[model samples]
Target: MTASVLLAADNLGVHVGTRALLRDVSFSLRAGEVLTLLGESGAGKSLLAQAVMGNLPAALRASGSVTLDGTTSRADDARARRPRWGRTVALLPQEPSLALDPLMRIAPQLSETHELVRGAAFDQAEAAALHDLEAAGLAASARQYPWQLSGGMAQRAAAAVACAGGARILLADEPTKGLDALWRDHTVAMLQGVQRRGGCVVVITHDLRVAEALGGQLIVLCAGQVVERGDARTVLADPQHAFTRRLVAADPARWPRRAAAPASAGAPVLSAQGLSKGFGGKPLFDGVDLQIRAGDRFVVQGPSGTGKSTLGNVLLGLMPADRGVVRRAEGLHATAFQKLYQDPVASFAPQITLGQSLRDVAARHRCAWPAVLQHLSRMGVPHDLLARRPSQVSGGELQRVALARVLTVQPALVFADEPTSRLDPVSQQEAMAVLLDALDERGAALMLVTHDDDIADAVATQRWRLAAG
Candidate 1:
């Protein structure tokens, strides 16, 4: 007998105060099937997932029917689905840093999910948790807190915990955002494992490689409307819609090699010698030395937990090196060095609107508010987004806003850590262009940390690789 439809949504719509964010979206999923949502940033992809899960924010309202395992409920009635959470449904949020509890150890978090949510015994839970961590290649980090793990490692841990409850219906939002190729494939395998167990998955992502790999059903959204829907491979291979075509073409693999020349001859912006860093008595990287010149683009490339971010922090003086000296050029303002953080939400004040945060930065830098607005415009950030707090906006939108904030300071050097990982291909290209253009205009140097080889190839004048020692 054919497997019954495990999940179905009908005429789903999401809105805030009559302003529709998502409209008339519908789909169904069966056991062993995967449904992937693809869209540009702020195109209501996440909102749709929230709608289906009955997890929309308080200000938003959802209208539709959500059917799970022959039971139907109002899409907006979150309470109706609360009991099913962690049992029948699970959501792997986009930002692992925020999703994982800060104070809890990774192993304990996984153990709790298995014991409490899955009704496993404590001993069984502990063993299962360790096994999960090992599968995610985080066995050594099982005892560590979320903050101690690198972004990619944390992403893996979060995935493990999300799946620990034995939830058959998984909603994974950008699950592979910060991962390297190995881990990316591993995550894809994990999702496939869910399918092999007769479960279904709903994934929201901008990663075409992931969408292509999942290869079940694909829905491309634009401005909250379905622009294209079909088999993932066929649609991506020969897109029919204009937006879909642009999205597919915007992949970094297709990007032309940059013609920009190295500015190594320019005056040094910063220099470091004999840099070393480690965690828990294990060295991540050791004895690294480098110099960054004005107008240079330096890329820090490495696998997860190899200390790419640690090196950036050490060079930026945000964190001290175990054994090194970093020298900055004289006559530069204290804010001459700014960083576009990997997690943009952490950089802003949670309680304040984005506008207020930008105003404060502008005031500190003696820049006009209009100048900040102009920078936001250059980065394609909407003016209305300024009214919301950092968590209220989409990740891609928040990332662009962060870059715009960085540019307002006219920094002499920028440490952009995986800055565009959350963005769709089209927005990724645009954001990179804006950043490079702004940096070139100001003759500023850049130290970028990313796992994307295409981006490194497209932008870096110099490359640095870190390996665990």
Candidate 2:
């Protein structure tokens, strides 16, 4: 197959405050091809995408030539190069929930894109947009608001809008991070269809399974530099760089198994009987029951929009259940959600440091701040990282900080919803190890919500499948 370059980044460099996020990074995407950007958390993967999209923060300074179809321009100039977006390029951000407007219907968004890109009239554009929506697996979601649609459905609608705009290059960041196997597979297939239609796709992801399934050219990044670049199978099966090899080796599926938990246990530390949650007449969880005893790691598995997150919310008292009762130990509970609830830029108080955030949570639970610092160090989070504000830290670092905050609480029961979704394989393994160790030491019970079977198999002492009732 003939290769035609669609986009290229030459010697891309970006600096956020005093920290150099990315430097001397270079890669290219071509029509009829999918290029996978593989990296751990905080490796500047997302920054690279934002830079490409001309959406980098104003505080950060960048120097690079991002070229589209043979036109080279500076970051500012490139952003202003219109007829650029929805025509030459498009972006599908990491979280569909954040990308979509909750109040707007999907069909209108597509129609707007058609009008903006193709100058089509309202009636003509609506018809063309509906056709594109159907092709993108969003036919049923045309009139649905973002909140009314599932994550997968919203993502599909977003892609349809991009397609309708006649974009030739698509950039997707962790597109399937929080989705299940079926949705993950379906999303990838939809992207592949884009490539087949003669467009180029660039996917920034931490999941090796996604890279493997997409069958793309793989480029590995670590600490803001390219470590490996080649065919997906070649790079994964026989990695040349030490970092690449370490990532492949760190897969949770490859972890050594621990002794199984005793089958017969004492009274359950947490229990839910006939839990049901619904919204706007749509039942999220019809009737789900689960039990967790001390030392038990129970995994709740299901596809996206199947109530995995709703179940977590119900457990945390953030959302009330319509029916059934959830009983927990008479103590504090800590949770880490699938999406980063805390603002990446301002999760910490402006006057306080990262260390203070940890200390505050520790003080609330009457725990020692020093002990929390020790745990953070053991988890590979530098002590100095505690001095940085959320705005200054990377996403991975922020997540680690959040995990540290949770640990300081010393809760009797913990609920983690896709805790490793945004983490790289190495960080994922490290975080899981710390969580399991702390739980084991405390003899606390855990209810983990995730779709990654490897994570479920690695950490779960018992497992339950939740389906739409």
Model-by-model lDDT, in order? Answer: 0.90, 0.76
What is the C-alpha lDDT profile of model 2 across 1-469, one tens digit per residue? Answer: 1236778888887886777888878877777888898887878888887788787767777777787766767865545645587788888876565566778898898898899787899899999988887776667568889767654566667666656776778888877776778878877887898799888888988888889988778989898888899999888999999999999998878977655578565357767899999876778887778777887887888765677767877876778999999887655343322222322332456567888778777777688878988878867788987776665655667777777777776656677767777788899898888988887887766778787888887777888787755
Candidate 1 segments exceeding 4 Å error: 1-3
TM-score of each: 0.98, 0.88
lDDT of 1: 0.90
**lDDT: worst 10-residue window of model 2:** 336-345
Kindly list the per-residue Cα lDDT of model 1 for residues 1-469, writing each as its tens digit: 1239888888899998989889999999999999999999999988887787787888899988887766788898888888898899899988897679999999999999999999999999999999999989999998899999898999999999899999989999999998999899999999999999999999998889999999999999999889999999999999999999999999998887776655655799999888888887899888778899998999998899998888888878889888978999999876899898898878889999999999999998899999999999988889999999887788999999999999999999999999999999999999999999898888898899988899899988998877767
Error of 1 at 139 (Å): 0.8
- Steric clash pairs (candidate 2): none
Clash pairs, candidate 1, are none
lDDT, residue 337, candidate 1: 92
Minimal lDDT window, size 10, model 1: 257-266
Q: After superposition on all CA atoms, what RMSD does each candidate show versus the true structure?
A: 1.3, 3.5
